[model samples]
Target: MVKLIGDLIKDVIEPGFCLGCNACVAACPMQCIKKEENEIPVLKTGCINCGICYGQCPQVVDPKTLQKAIFGDNPTDELLGTYTQALAVEAKDAIMKAHGQDGGAVTALLSSLLDDGYIDGAVVVGTGEAPWQPVARVATTTGELIECAGSKYTRTPLFIGLRDAVNLYYRKRVAIVGTPCNIVASWRMQFSEPTNRHLGETIRLRVGLFCGGVFRYKEFLKDIIERQLRAPLAEVAKFDMKDGRFVIYLRHKPKRELALSAVKRYIDLPCKICSDFTAEFADISVGSAGSPHGRSTVLIRTPTGAEAFDVAKKFRKFSAVELEKVKPGIEGVRLEAKAKKGAAAKELEIMRRQKKPLPVWLQERPPEPPKETIESLKSISRV
Candidate 1:
């Protein structure tokens, strides 16, 4: 009998229909799947059937349910404010100061988890030369967490690490720091075969960050090109999310102000479809949205998250930023969200289609792309 990979992850049979896209076949880690004509993926031997393809498939047999399942329930009236709240967590290690984008709140949280023996390792999205590099970084020390700091704007698809994370647990525990989609991967990973024993036992924490939308890494690079003079990607310094704008820094300082037309073309697909800017699924959603430099805007969800923040508060790792500076941006986000509800998605569609790709950076690893000053990071870093 022909078996479907979806059966392993869920009770429902996986969709047999195909968009004839080779995404799943190309993405399969086990090399167990093959693509036929019209992008129909055929299962093969050694098919551990990890079900990675099920998530990557563009054609959803079930759109409404699928979209809701991934996005979670829509906004309620009470769910105002950013998805994250401003708070601190005890990350005693000094690594928090160096790694990450700015104030290093995420580094601190991961360190606390590692030091407290709460988790053996964590799954996070580390920036790579290209995109979609969502692998797990086993953090045995605080320094490791710092090394993999910052909010990687590209779609890291971090959920892919669940299987590996379970392997590393060795019956211990692990934490996950990711975006909403990454968290969605976690939720899906729960049932996706070989049932993760560690998931129930040791996958202890989930650290999330306030997100505007999910975008494609390719689009981001393309945007860089539109801004630069079609330079090759030399280095990526920053993906600044301040003032309601996403500022991309490239290595070639000469061609700074890229054409706005190019940027529109390179924006990702999901962010265009999605309206949720804040992640409600995360344990603690953190950001620099409203917080001043050297600070982070944190939102605590679970009790553990609140407790973690409480403990971290004692260290005085960050100062507070005035809410006013961030207010305009947040307001802009709300307006954007509102626009997403009806006609705006269409407007974006037109804008996207008409937009042209900009230029690429000249070199790789450009000078640590400019980061907001420590004082600025501190402003958003704490409660």
Candidate 2:
């Protein structure tokens, strides 16, 4: 029998494997799944049990299957995944360079795509009503995109923003900016059984950010930043993870730094099991891992990513240094990726030894029925 939302909740969410990407909420045809702020999706009444929600979940879907669907080959690179080229990029836009988290390459690239009419809008994470809280929204212009720049250490359900961009805003073509989990969720929506192919068709570009992990907002911002450090969240200018420390910049005040070890316990539970460090399935993967202080490491993984990057470069939106020229180069990114994968593997082994429930992706199971077979069965059942 096929698994449903209840199974998803018991196996993934209860086991603390849900990535909170909101793909299931977006792909639900009956609108039964509701995505709560910083919470796993809740299934309301009227679920048809079509299995789309279970299939679209990033935690449940196998990464290797999605990789083959998106990249057309089994990736041999263990650390960084398959990619065409790597570069260190610094945004040429002064505002983006100054305000963006690192090099602002993602902001610059999105701006270029919007200005050139390559994409109708982009799904991005912006500041919410509460200070430093991440909220996902659609950016249709460069100004809006710029406002959405910078990193939020907290997780948001970005795929909901993609749904609104296409379904509500009527954007025909959209770009999605997210972390590795979000990218996996996108691919799951695109290729999973009982697919929401129409929704996936609007996603023209996938730009993934490098992530170490995300923290719970209340824990990290409230307990650590506000209470412990005595720094007001409203006065905060930016957040950065650098040199093994979590750095906080405040307005008109001296910045404060906390060793990553100090806040390690605040990291969200779902992040511990994640292995993808560089968003291997994205069109283009970007992060600060392999670049200098004011630059981002860009990995063009597919032709779509290469084309977009080339167009942005031809317009001089950013300056780039080939991977070979950058100090430490891909080695820096490789080391981090390797470490993350190693840690996740160790954790999974421990969980297995404990007989803990694992996500479907990590479980040994027979292949799911194809979409055609599922449709035929549905037809027969209705008869």
Candidate 3:
């Protein structure tokens, strides 16, 4: 049963453990893992066996909920305080603010690292006339970094920078900021290529954002058009994860509004299979929802992340608040996530327990990524 999580972690680090959560299907390097009824995780058995899922699972998957698991009862160190939206401020009160959600704490953190010469560059996302464009960018300055703000909840591949970082790793280090899936991909790449001496050694930091959820690129956009506004899915240029709600402003004759409930119903087949809400492989993971403005909520997962952030704090880039205690409400979200996954997994084990006929939903593949970008929609975010 993999009773000990440490055992699971070790097995996963080497040969691997499934924990029965099916994130592997969506993020598979080989496009494996299929969904059965209700969209649960099912190892295709035909899987090419790429290990993306092993590294991405919440570093600790308690299976009970989607909430972050605090294994130790250690006092909550106020690495940074919680914020809503009011606390935001600029970088130098810098140029990045123009691009970020609010004042741009994220930009500030990345910019600080760059300005101090700590990192040679920042791996970030920027928008293009299409979805693929927002997937990658190597930001080296405040202006270049901020241009890629707003919530981009689609799945992106961070390994896109793997080659570039390796090429430039000699003189400077690189810090990567991304969602859970992207972070795990990069982390694995580093372990595999660590001694590259140039790129692997140069990639120094991983910053993960607390994830509310990630949707399939096409399905998410489709929901906004069909269910919510009953309008054309004009374009979804910019998005944000704020206040426990996924806020996406749509563009229609007048503008259109979409709610999370309708979107949740349409989550992609891949998301339904895997269940890590926080990017567990990152060095430091950030989240909003309960975190207010001006203040950023940070989870210091690695000693390196803690040290790097401490260095930034010394520069007065921003101030931080230490939670006397983490609110149960905040933890509740994760718990719910974990529970949802558990119920689904138990069902998988039950039906498959017999090695008999298991529920199955198969599809003929060979589909291309959607050519869905409408040039006209790009204007919505700019205006």
Cα lDDT tens digits, model 3, 48-125, are: 334544433433333222112111122232212112112222344645544566446677887778777777788776
| Candidate of highest TM-score | 2
TM-score per candidate, chains pooled = 0.63, 0.92, 0.60
* Candidate 1 global TM-score: 0.63
lDDT of 2 by residue, 159-193 (tens): 88988998899998899999998988876666566
Tell me each candidate's RMSD, in Å, in order: 12.2, 4.8, 12.8
Residue 345 miss distance in model 3 (angstroms): 4.4
- What digit string (tens of lDDT, one per residue) describes model 1 on residues 240-301? 55544556566556434444333544444444544344455555766665554665656665
Off by over 4 Å in 2: 366-383
Off by over 4 Å in 3: 1-98, 131-133, 168-172, 192-199, 222-237, 242-244, 250-257, 293-295, 324-383
lDDT of all the models against the reference?
Answer: 0.48, 0.83, 0.48
Ranking of all predicted structures according to TM-score, beginning with the best and ending with the worst: 2, 1, 3
Per the 3 Å backbone cut-off, how many clashing residue pairs does candidate 1 have? 45
Report the CA-based lDDT of candidate 2 relative to the real structure.
0.83
> In candidate 2, what residue range of length 10 has the lowest lDDT sum?
374-383
Best by lDDT: 2
